[model samples]
Target: MGPNVHIWRHSRCRGAGWALTSPRARSQAVPGTPRHPLVLTETAAVSLLNCLFLPRVAEAASLPSALPLSASWKELVAMWLPAGKASGRLMKNSSTSPLAEKQGQTSMEASSQSVQATSGYPSTSTSTSTECKPQVLPVIIPILLSILFVACLVLNSTSLWIFWFHIKRWNSSLILQFNLVLMDTLLIPIVPLMVTYFSLGNSWLFGQFLCQLKIFILSTHLYGSIYFLTLISIHRYLAVAHYSTRTLWKKKSFLKKLSLFVWFVLCIQGLPLFFVLKTSVLNGTVKCLSIHQSEFSSVYLYYSIFLVTISFLLPFGISLICYALLGAIIMKMSSTSLRGRVMKTKSLQLIMVSLAIFIICFVPLHVSRTVGVIVKYYNMSCKLLLQVEIAYYASWVFTLVNCCLNPLIYNFSSEKFNESFSKSLRKFRFFK
Candidate 1:
């Protein structure tokens, strides 16, 4: 018999109310007992017994299952002895220990917290965030740009050639029309680049310098077109409203100086685009004119707003006022001589054509651009930002339609344009 058997039997006897001697007395009489005939010292026996049963006691206590009788005996003995202090608690009476239950509850709470964290909010990481991309107008934009580029190149080139070679008398309206055609011709070269950009999903393959140049040139074209249109409107207004006054509208030198002044103002206004417009890599792709919200965003925002006001809104207002006054004067002249009425009728037709071109080509673009600037600098929600991006690009492409449409407007509205175009086409054998 060993000390483990003695400990077991001693626990059984204690449960049965048997009186046990002290460990010292038990060691002195252990060799004389019937069950334990071995002569082991008290300290050595306790050491051996602890080495044998302490690990089992700890394993049984840490688990959620109920302890066996032998483990429970070891645990109760360990509770009264100081040597078993290092061993952890045991599940003696219940099926599960308090520590084990608490651990399980904590694990469940952690799992639920992880789930809530994932499902509660939108991800703010750049990799997972939603970004606004340009809308793909599959057939409309590419086709329109293609046709417009060809027509604008041919018509504007022909107009410039005729203005230089054939049309010698440069009236105020003729000079303004020449400037308009010049602006349109300058803008026509950018259309192929734009077509490639949009066709490639708005990815700009050109270098950063070209990107900045493209934006600068486009901005100049937009305001230049508007300024010339406004000048044309004012000329028509003067021709109708103040027919007797001999002002600068009849002087070739004054008209030339005015054109130069308009160009200077537009160039000054567009100087910021050369500095502010830039290309950056977004989502592993190069994007042009992509202004992000930054410390300078407000500065760019206010500048952009001012540009739109001066270039687009102001010209639009001036054109409207001029046309309105011209219309009233023409109406009053309806009861005058038949020749005067016929001339007023032709003027009204031309005014209507100019207004239609302005509204159709520029209005949607400026409105969408204004909204986009607001949404961009202010950091609006993703959905509205996406919508504004689509509208802005679509209207941008629509505005380019004006480059080609202006020649048509001039052909129909001006008798000189018609005569010049006809003579040029016949000279080039386009019409026999």
Candidate 2:
């Protein structure tokens, strides 16, 4: 006798999900939505109806054992109309009577409102999505992030100290490495807050401004580190394979200037995050910089794709090409001395480690995040979106590993710096 049943029985077309309304309800527009509603041919009404009403209908009346699960609309009427004369009359008049039409229209309006309230990429308000909760994030991501923070802080601080005070000679490669270290170190102060946030079940205690600042710093660190690693790869390639570029490689000023440019570009890229990265109080807890905290537009989706392409993909490709070429150049050399073999071994190690960072850290992070952005904008199913969210967070945790692994690059790429770092480590009683 409910209006919901009348709306579905009178609907002329089918739709995906539990759309208990006419086709007109599908055209309701939200952010990132097209002007026209996307039509889906799969019928969900029967299943939804059976799921919602069948058990009660069966329990109220003595149902036949031969009742088919895929009962037609008329069959459903026959099965349920016997339960009560009132419901039977209501069903009979639902199509032809004006009052029934009015009830169905009212039901359509209510269902449309519910759909619009729940669907879309998240907006400025808190999300009510219960299906998209990540099960492993609270346990896995916080532990990984904490371990990464400790390891990266110690390694990067030691590297920074060596580069600043112990190693007197600075070249293009050292300049690049030092800049990379600075990026990693800059991220150090932000990690504990993030760890605490994840540890406390994604609840952020910090205010909105710090939330935006945290996201900005994280973005800057990720892309800045990628840029410097690519630069290091190219510099090493030129230094080892092309003797003619040695003089250029010896000049540190060019790299310093380039580092400034990189930071400027990163700042430009991260500036927009402040507007979109907002904190929302959900279930009385503040959630910061969550994908669910803001609405996504078509423009934002395109920008995210562009960022993934340029910031992550482009640098990863360049690093791969440079390392491949370096590998080839190292292979062609016929040197048999210990020093030559040592350099060759180190070069190969650098290639593997750098490629590991790219593959493990950058690739999945960008791909999963970009896919998640697309899925969110298109308002995909909660299960698919949940999978993407899991992948994105896990890959993001892997990205922090790069900060710990990058110090290996300094040791591999430069002999003098490596010796200095070794001596510094040996001075510690722990290393001794």
TM-score of each: 0.67, 0.70
Candidate of highest lDDT: 2
Over 1-432, each residue of candidate 1 has an lDDT whose tens digit, in order, gives 333334444544233211123445345564556633233443434443443455445455442222233344456454535433433333445477777777655654543443235335343445535556544446566666777788778878888887788776655678888889889887977888888887887788989888888988898899899999898888878876777899878677899999999999978887887787678777677878753324356767788788778778888899999989988887777556887866776777777778877888888887887787788776677678777766777787678778767776566446687788888778779645
Over 4 Å off in model 1, which ranges? 1-139, 291-296, 335-338, 412-414, 426-432
Please give, for residues 185-218, the per-residue lDDT of candidate 2 as tens digits: 9899998998888888888888889998998998
Instruction: Locate the minimum summed-lDDT window of 10 residues in model 1.
Output: 13-22
* lDDT values for all models: 0.70, 0.75
In model 1, what are the clashing residue pairs, if there are any?
Answer: none
Worst window of 10 by summed lDDT in candidate 2: 36-45
How many clashes in each candidate?
0, 0
Which number leads on TM-score? 2
Off by over 4 Å in 2: 1-136, 244-247, 430-432
Model 2 accuracy (lDDT, Cα):
0.75
TM-score of 2: 0.70
